[model samples]
Target: MSTIEKAMEQLNRSPGNAESVKPKLQTDELSTKVKIATAYSEKIEDKEVSVSHKKQKTLFIDDARLKSLGMISLNASMSERLVRDEFRVIKQKLLKNAFGVNRQETLANNLVMVSSANPNEGKTFISINLALSIASEQDKTVLLIDADVLSPSIDECLDLGEQAGLIDYLSGEIDDVGDIIYPTSVPDLRIMPAGRAHHMSYELLSSDRMLALMQELANRYSDRIIVLDCPPLLGVVETVTLSNLIGQAVIVVEQNKTKISDVKQAVALLNSDMNIGFIVNKAVHKAGYGYGYGYGYGYGYGSKGKNK
Candidate 1:
C-alpha cells in the first residue's frame, strides 16, 4: 500500500491510548516563550461505536437568530449575497488546500481551524460562515466543532443549550464521538458543542486520546471538512495545543481593532507547516462596496519550517 493509505489504516486501527506523535509542550515554558516572542516586537474521543447506527442529535438554528447576529443563513437573499460571495472565495481557497493538486496529502488538510490573535475578533463569525458556505457545496460535507472550551459560544450562536461535546469526549465522559455530533438544519452541516468547562482542558486537548480522535476525524470521510472554532491564539494554551493537529488555520483580524503586534505574536505560535490564512473582520470598503469583511490567504510570515 502507498504510504498515505498505510498511515490512514494505522490511524483507523490505532487504539485511543496510542502515543501522540506530536511533541508535548511545557505549558509554563511555552507561555514564557510566547511572552518573549511578543516582547521582541514581532519576534515572534476514542469511540468504537459506528455513526451509522447511532441516532444523532439534531441542532436547530433559527434563521431569524442568525440574521440578528449578522451571520449567513441558508436560502440567503440578494442582500446577503455579498457576504456569501466573500465566503465562497474563502472556502474555495481552503478546499483547494485540502484537496487540490498542490495539496499536501500527508497532513490533515481536511481539518481546518478558525481562530484569532485575541477574543472578539469575529473568529466564530467566520467559522460559522465558512462552514455554512462549504455546506452549500454539492460535493462537500462540513463539521463545525466548538473547540473554545474555555468560553464556548457556538451553542449560543446557534441557539443551542449546553450540550455534551469535545470536552465530554476528551474527558472520557462520552464514549462515542458520534453521539456528540449533532446534525444541523443545514443538510450538509453538523456541529459538536464545546461541552462543559474543565480545569484540565489544556491537558485534555494535548492528550493521546485527542490526537487519536483527530486522526479518525481527518480520515473518516474523504469529502468531509472539519472546521474548528478555537480560542484566541494568545493566553489560551489549548488553542496552540489544538493547532498541532490541524492542517490549516484562518486567523481573524478585526480591521481597526486588532493590533498588528498581537497578530504577529499569535502567528508565531501556530504550526508553521500549516497553511495559514487571514480574514479582516469588519472592514470598510470605499464607496459602493460599503463596509464588509475581507479575506486573504498565504503561507506563514517567514521561514518554511513547521512550528515546533
Candidate 2:
C-alpha cells in the first residue's frame, strides 16, 4: 500500500529480474540511505558557507600611508619612536588593568572604550594609537571596533572603504560576527568598521544583542584586547550606553580646548566603578618646544590622580 511496498512489488514482478529480486529493504536500511543523502547535502552546504567566509576582504593599512596621515606607522623614525613610547606607557597601564591581579574586580577589564567630552578632541587619534600599541605586544592581540556609528572615521583614517561591520552584526543584517570583523596588515591587529549608519543607532547600541556581543568579545580569547572608539560622551546617549558594557574608559582632553565642566559631566555619565584614565592631548610645556602629553589614572569621581 505504501510507496516502498509498491516499489518492492514491481521489482518482484519484473520478468527477467525475478531471479535477481532481493529481499525487501529493512526500515533501518532505508533510514541509513536517507541519512547518507542528508549528510552529503549538509557537507555541500557547509562548503558553500566556508567559501563565502573566505571571500571576506582583508583591510590593508599601508605604513607609508599612515605616516602621511600623521599617524604612528611601522617606521623607526625618532618622532614615531616617541609616539610609540608614549602609547607604550599608556598600554602598559591598560594591560595591567586588563590582565593583572585586579582584573577580577572589573566586569570586562579587557574591554576598553576611548572617548572624549566632545567631538574633534583627538579621541579617534588616541583610539587608533592605543590599538596599534597594544597590537605590538608579544603576548596579546587587539581588535579595534569603530563604535562611533553616527560619525565613523576609522575606515576613513585607515583608507578603508565602506563595508559591513559592527552595526551589521548588531542589527541582525549579518548573521555571523566574523563576517564583519576584518583582518588587517598589522600582525595582531583586527578592525571592525562602523557599518552602514542607521536611524536607530542609539537603540541598537543599547540593545541586548550589543551586550551579548560585548560579553562574547571579552571572554572569547584570554590574550585578546578590544578597544572601542566611542563617540564623545556629551550629547551622545549611545556613549553612555556603551560605558556600561566596558571595563575601562579613556577620556581624551584636548589642551586649551575641552572645558573642565564638560569633562566632569562626561565622567559623571560613565560607569562609576570603571577604571578611568585621562590623556591630555596637545599640551604644551613651559619651554614650548614640542607638544607635551600627560596621562593620569584615576577611579570614579574621587580619583587620586597620578600623572605618568
Give the alpha carbon lDDT tens digit for every residue of 216-308 in model 2: 787677999999999889998878876776777878766567776677778777655566766655533323122233321111112212111
Model 1: per-residue Cα lDDT over 83-152, one tens digit each:
6665776677678868888666666878888999888777777888899889999999999999888878
Error of 1 at 142 (Å): 0.2
For model 2, what is the C-alpha lDDT against the true structure? 0.68
The ten-residue window of minimal lDDT in model 2 covers: 27-36
lDDT for residue 67 in candidate 1, whole number 0-100:
54
